[model samples]
Target: MLSGKTLVVAAGIFLLGLVSFGEAIMGGSEAAAHSRPYMASIQAVEGDAMKHECGGFAVADQWLMTAVHCLPAGPNGRKVVLGVHSLSQAEDTKQTFDILELHNHPQFNPDNYDNDIALIKLDRPFNSTEAVKAVAFLRAGGVNPDTNAEVETAGWGSLDNLGNRPDALHEASMGVVSSTRCGRSDYFGRKFTGNMICAHKLCPDPCDGPHRIVDSCDGDSGGPLLYNGVAVGITSNGGKKCGQVKKPGIYTIISHYTEWIDGVMGLQPDA
Candidate 1:
């Protein structure tokens, strides 16, 4: 049976005199420009070092969607880097934005990872281009997708549990598993809530050839779980060891919070 452990969310509280958890890039390969244009790299800049904390996505000219745990209330020296493919090199297509406001959900429960979503308002609007684009949300009241549907997860975290962070963005294919399966005795069990989703990594047949044991870990928090170009989930928590068999990565389901998100973004509830 699984122990009741509060699996650490990717980025620790940085702006509040807290420690920053160095985590990310587990089980994904380099991503291309067109693959995930809405992707945003959230960072904390301190003097000479700029650290990648979490991943987010633009939903509007001045609004972004991310995990509440990524940002603790109060001020922080954080920014969002968009339209870039590499973290080490600055490309002409890249643009940076200063975070003017962080609107974490009012009812967010950190103890159980409930309402693990938040929105970021940019100091200025992003000039949309081919490299930088806003993504559509998972429409409200949509039918629950099939458990077998492929979910594409992207981030700049680590490649393994205790590995080094990747210099480039990486993406991987995973499959949505039944919450019942994910909540089995061996998994999170009753700790899994309705707001959470579970995705299992796909391991290739080593006997045949190349196959990645794709699963989110370390620094993938706040990243998106995209389905048909819509972000349906956000990376939340997972097992202690990423990519472990039967230890699926959990995400915050977006559909359940569309009304809350709409309210925060000042859009119609049904919009």
Candidate 2:
């Protein structure tokens, strides 16, 4: 029902800087230090410096999960920063690893963002500690949270549409929106797919302003969307603005790709 080519063209437009990448935690508060040990900061390694590009979460001793779009088109000069709360502060618990392999979903369509998920294998397993741990994820055939269910997401992305980002990690609490409603004509329309999930927190009053809405914005892509402490989704995309009314943040449903995840992790499915 979706055209990959069309989505590719749209992605191309984004690459040309015509449209902004929807990824960040708008109107959220800073997370407690090292509270989200599973959180992973994906950074692009530029000469003598590293720039935060997207968010991710550790899924295994050597594996992290994130949005496929976060991976560079050519040679990935990326690294994962784990067990960190503030990117600017150096903590003794901080751990860094070079990316050994990047496995993007074979069917991923960047244009439309369908199957917009990927797995990153670190060069070595993490040395476990209080500030560095792996997160549990939804398995294939797992039940998804019902509509309106409360969920949490964390990131080091921009705090607002003006592109203000914080050094410390920020988090937001929002509710899940049914795919049916998300696919409605007024929302994402036909662009929304079953493999995607939407989440948002409406402002108490529209007159209150966009800052009252909780959402993920630029630099937050590939972060986890948690439901009952389980990693259920990956931040995929959203509207042009961070917290637009009736337009929710979309995520790649992790449960939908458990098979692929298992394959990449070298795990066999239950018989």
Candidate 3:
């Protein structure tokens, strides 16, 4: 049931491609991709227990935002792990956190991926002392308003572009692109909208697709789009495949729902 609008959004993303706006996938620098501090160990909907879908932090101790696609259908899904950077030791006793509650857009269209973002309330506030620290959010109107910014994104999802799991976390850096130009791509023309952000390809763009970044793929959805030390967006959807130069990775624009996020999550608006 891909609505025409959803298809248009997908087409928009396919044309724009994943670009690093204002920063890289690992924070602000390319070297920061594999770096800790900004990373989080998310475990969502693993069978009956909390499944370990990939997600990361935005505020220092409050919210853990993610892609709605990570949520398991129905009430059977669960969440685990909270503040940890190393997957090798993420399962260690002290680093894990149980599920609190899950919040996804009520009108999410699975086919169209509208409202693709979600929040995982933590059972307990994140500890001040941990290898994984929450990322910062761009002040209400402080950053990329429409499209195109230098930024970074990171995740520990399955490395293989085609698979749905990953052995550990990996990071990548790239730049953002204009939404207007995004629609001109062979795949995603005029699909860009106010809620979606695009990342263009790099010199050695690995794979080739309108909706994917060769450096990052599946399992990384819901991760952060950090620009200048702020978590400004969340990974949304990729085109049909990974690494098509014609395609780029699209993300949920964090600013679009400012009031809804503050209102629903009960957080103060950014000054």
lDDT of 2 by residue, 192-230 (tens): 999999998875433134336788888989999999999
**Candidate with maximal TM-score:** 2
In candidate 1, list every pair of residues with a backbone clash: 23-219, 24-157, 24-158, 24-218, 24-219, 25-157, 25-158
Query: Which scores better on lDDT, 1 or 3?
Result: 1
The regions of model 3 sitting more than 4 angstroms off are: 1-34, 44-51, 58-60, 72-75, 90-94, 145-148, 162-166, 205-215
Which segments of candidate 1 are over 4 A away from where they belong?
Answer: 1-27, 206-212
lDDT tens string, model 3, 1-271? 9999999999878544434221122121123323545565566455454444665654546567777777746324454454444554434323556657778877666775667778777678766554556666664566673454566777775544436454455666667866766567565765555677777445433433323334345667778887776788788776765555556677787777677677767888655
The order of the candidates by lDDT, greatest first, is 2, 1, 3
Once model 2 is optimally superposed onto the true structure by TM-score, how far is the C-alpha of residue 183 displaced, in angstroms?
0.2
Show where candidate 2 strays beyond 4 Å.
1-26, 72-75, 205-211
Give the Å error, residue 17, model 3. Answer: 22
lDDT by residue (147-231, candidate 1, tens digit) is 8788888888777656578888888877899888888888888778898888865555321223345678777788889887688
Whole-model lDDT per candidate: 0.78, 0.86, 0.61
